[model samples]
Target chain A: MSERAQQLLEIADDELLLGWRNSEWTGIAPFLEEDVAFSSIAQNEIGHARALYELAGRDLGKTADELAFDRAPEEYRSAALVEPRFVPDWARTIARHYLYETADQIRIEALKASDDAEVAGLAAKIDREEVYHRMHAEMWLERLVGEPRVREALVELWPKALGVLGDDLRPLLRERLAALDLPEVEPVERGKHSGELAELWEKMTVVRRSVPGATW
Target chain B: MSAQEQAFLEYVQGGGQVETSDWMPAEYRARLIKFIEMHGNSELMGVLPEREWILRAPTLQRKLALTAKVQDEVGHAQLIYRVVEDLGKPRAACLQDLIDGKSKFHNVFHYPTKSWGDVGVIAWLVDAAAIISQKALLKCSYAPYARIMKKICWEESFHILHGRDVILTMMNGTDEQRTLVQEALDRWWGPLMQFHGNPIAQGDDPSFSWRIKSQSNDEARQQFLDGYVPQIWELGLTVPDPKLRKDEEADRWEYSEPDWAELKHVVTGNGPRTKGRLQLRRTSRAETDWVRRALLAEAA
Candidate 1:
């Protein structure tokens, strides 16, 4: 695969895994209204993944489904930050959402100027959807900002959030922290999968692999 | 009814709407909660049957569509329960009552879905049938419920298109694939027919008297038939009701009487999959109890 295809997969795999993680809250979120709002965010992430996969698949001689589900656990390029199953925990979930969307906004803005028109175009489209996601995550962050536990959760997850951005992207992400007056930490950049990735991969692909060659 | 009740009845009788804070008779309040509560419960329980498919969906398109459909159901539950919550019941209490079987959900969700065929048929005809009743609810006497219905109806529009797309793809595929659609439709027709509930005359129904439902049970069922019977026939899938027909003369549909007794039994927590579905809800809730406590506890 070309350099473009590999870069696109990293983004797609990150989103696909994170979207899958977020969806685990569909029926079991903290409350009903918030559950609805959170589900939409999950759908948006998956939708972003689909669009990204389509862009990458053109160069890889495959379809989005093949890219999303046909890969082995080790082959997936998603970061550890998005691979955990953190249902029922609103603080951690919201923390991760805020962190990831913030990190994603940074990366997507950079991609928006890609030489490849299709990749750049898809990034522009996804950024539109991510705006709502950022607003939603910020809403919860503001709502819970006064609480000690929530504040602690946000602090604990900050480094992992940094991990989502690249070494060079760290400068931009650091500026975001300086604006918030938050203390900086070592960044957890992409490339390494978490221990959680294996478990996520098993469940994520179980159903797809169940009946090989049969149409859904 | 007394003079005041009689006057109130006349207002709704002539198509009046009520808001959450509006004055309502004791009977109207009770009936509205019972009726609307069941709908909220139905949306919540409804997620279980369809959610499994999200885990097992064959293709990327199918997976995303199925996930969105299920996610919309969760969103609908949120929208619905809020209406019920404003009606004097807390959502936590409603959920507790649901887990305890003190409340009810629709009968269709209480049954099991066997294969991908069941997924397509339920989304196609079941949601289509449901949208007929929900469309009627857009004009419900209660204002808050009615407003939420607008959003609910808008979201459901996508489910129908998604359902139709799924079923159509299967229908146009292999012979076995077509059979899946046909067989699933055959099994679902009886439940879909009985879904709208026993027909009561317009004047005799309390929900209609207070305009909680702008359409009668039979009226909604007829609308479903009038709108969808032709759609079904075009797919070359026969409904289980052999007597089904559209009398262009009456501009209405005719079909065999649904077994009202069976509907009563199934919806009252005795359906085939009711126990198992409820058990799943209970288990998941229990497992996740800490999340609510962790957040709510902090709030408290």
Candidate 2:
């Protein structure tokens, strides 16, 4: 694969997996309105993933669905940060939401500066949607920042949050955290898979695998 | 009835609309709340079955569509509960009643969704059945509800399309896929028939007289059959009822009597999946209790 294609797959995989994790709260979110709002965000993440996969698929000669769902778990390039399941835990869910949006904003900003016009254009479009996502996450962050449980959850997930960013973007994330008076933690860098991704892949691909060579 | 309530009834019967702030009889208000609350509860509970498939959706497109569809249902629940809240009960209380089995939702929701095909059938047929009743609500005497029904019906149109697309794709695919759709249809046919409720004369039903429901139970059922049976038949799928057919000369459908006993049994919280689904609702509510408290505290 071309370097551009590989780069796109990494970002796309992160989104696909993160979207999958976020959707786990579809019906059972804390309240009705929030349930609807959060589900939209989940759909948005997957949508962003699909757009990215389509762009990447062009270079790899595959369809977006194939790129998104057909890859082996070992071939998945998602960050460990987006791999864990967080249903029924609003604290950690929000903690992850706030952190991932922060990290994704940084990454998208860099992609928006890419020399490839198509990549740059898609990045710009994704950044437009992420604006609301950021607002939502920041809104929750402001509300829960004063709570001890939220603070603990943020602290607990801080390392994983750092893993979502590359070394170049990690400094920017740290700067943002420092502005919010958040303490820095050791980074859990990307490039490794946990058992969590394998489990998610199992459920995600079960239906598609059941009837091989069938269109759904 | 009191002279005041008698006047209110006659006004509604004569096609008058009632606003939330308008004068209404005590019985009218109570009846409105109960009916609307159950509709809201059904929308909320309806999410559980489809949510499972959102994870297992075969393609990214299917996954996105299913997730958005589920999201729309939750949105519908929110809009519905707001109307109910205006009527008297709070949204939280409605939810509590739902999980406690003190209230009821639609019969179809209480059953299990066994496969990807069930998802398609539900979106196509179950939603088709629901849209029939909801369309009747467009002429409801309660102005607030009738207004919201317009938006709800508009969104339901897309769900039916999505469902038909899913089913059609499966039906056109491999033999295994076709079998999946057929089996799902077989399992769902009973609930779909019972969906509009037992056939009752419009004059005998209180909901119909109040103009809360402008159509009779059998009227809604006939509408559903007229609209969907051909769609089902054209796909080479059987209706699972040997007696089901259109009576052209009589201008009505002739079918075996729906199992009213089972409809009552399932909706009363004894269906195959009701206990497990409600238990999930109860547990999730308990787990999120602190989140609501903390968030509300901050807002206050």
lDDT of 1 by residue, A67-115 (tens): 8888888888777688777765666887788778888999999999888
Q: What is the C-alpha lDDT profile of model 2 across A32-131, one tens digit per residue?
A: 8788878899899999999999999988999999998888999998887899888988998999999999999999999999999999999999999999
lDDT tens digits, residues B1-300, model 2? 999889999999999999999999888888899999999999988999999998999998999999999999999999999999999899989988998899999999999998999999999999999999999999999999999999999999999999999999999999999999999999999999999999888888888888899988898999999999999999989899999989999999999999999999999999999999999999999998998898889879
Off by over 4 Å in 1: A88-92, A109-125, A138-216, B201-203, B242-257, B283-300
Residue-wise C-alpha lDDT for candidate 1, range B196-257, written one tens digit per residue: 98888988877887888878788888988888888888987878887898888998888998
Question: Which model scores highest in TM-score?
Answer: 2
**Cα RMSD to the true fold for all candidates:** 3.9, 1.1
Instruction: List candidate 2 stretches off by more than 4 Å.
Output: A180-184
Report the Cα lDDT for residue B153, model 1.
89
Docking model 1 quality class:
acceptable
Q: Whole-model lDDT for model 1 versus the true structure?
A: 0.81
Checking candidate 1 for backbone clashes, the offending pairs are A163-A188
